[model samples]
Target: MTTLPQFALTVLGLLFCAGDVAALALLLTWQERAPSPDARRLRLLRGVLPASALLLALLLLAVVQLALL
Candidate 1:
């Protein structure tokens, strides 16, 4: 019952989510090894990025689902 556009949108959303996760993973690993004094800023980013990405991806998927309906 799924159309091509719907399928594509789902894939896009998953990819976006995966990309954000990968980028965050890379940042975490790199930051851990690097000597940095801005640990507080990193902690703030660690809190913010994933939540924002999840919200945006969910919003995109919601819009796509509404379009299909």
Candidate 2:
């Protein structure tokens, strides 16, 4: 299968980093308005999980890009 070039992967990583920051801000804002501890935790997790996943994915992409080079 074809793979993305290192430069492209690097750009994608940057974009993901920006997205993660935004997600964190939104998560914190949501947490402040949450009604209960359980609800707060759930909302925080909901915001965090996807950002974490994206970070992991970006890490993997970097690794793959390195391997290709």
Candidate 3:
């Protein structure tokens, strides 16, 4: 099987990380506008942020590994 190049993987990982950052920013902005934001919404955002971070980390690691190869 052919393997993809490192630079490509790194770029892809960065794109994913950027998306996560964007989502987090949107959530923060929404929270600021909310008048007594719903507890459930806050809880969901709490969960989403960590999960997204984890995903970004994993992708970054993959990119690094590919680069090293």
RMSD of each: 5.2, 5.3, 4.6
Global CA lDDT computed for model 3: 0.65
Clashing pairs in 3: none
Best by lDDT: 2
Encode model 3's per-residue lDDT on 1-69: one tens digit a residue. 335565566677678767757766775565566566585477557765676577667657756765676
lDDT per residue as tens, model 2, 1-69: 335665676677667667756766775676779899888788668865676677667756755665665
Worst 10 residues of 2 by lDDT: 1-10
Q: Candidate 1: deviation at residue 51, Å?
A: 11
Model 3 segments beyond 4 Å from truth? 1-4, 37-69
In model 2, where do residues sit more than 4 Å from their true spots? 1-4, 35-69
Name the top TM-score candidate. Answer: 1
After TM-score superposition, the amount by which residue 3's alpha carbon in candidate 3 deviates from its true location, in angstroms, is: 9.5
Model 3 per-residue lDDT at 4: 55
TM-score of each: 0.50, 0.45, 0.49
Q: Report lDDT (CA) for all predictions.
A: 0.65, 0.68, 0.65
| Model 1 whole-model lDDT (C-alpha atoms) | 0.65
Off by more than 4 A, model 1: 36-69
Candidate 1 clash pair list = none
lDDT of 1 at 31: 54
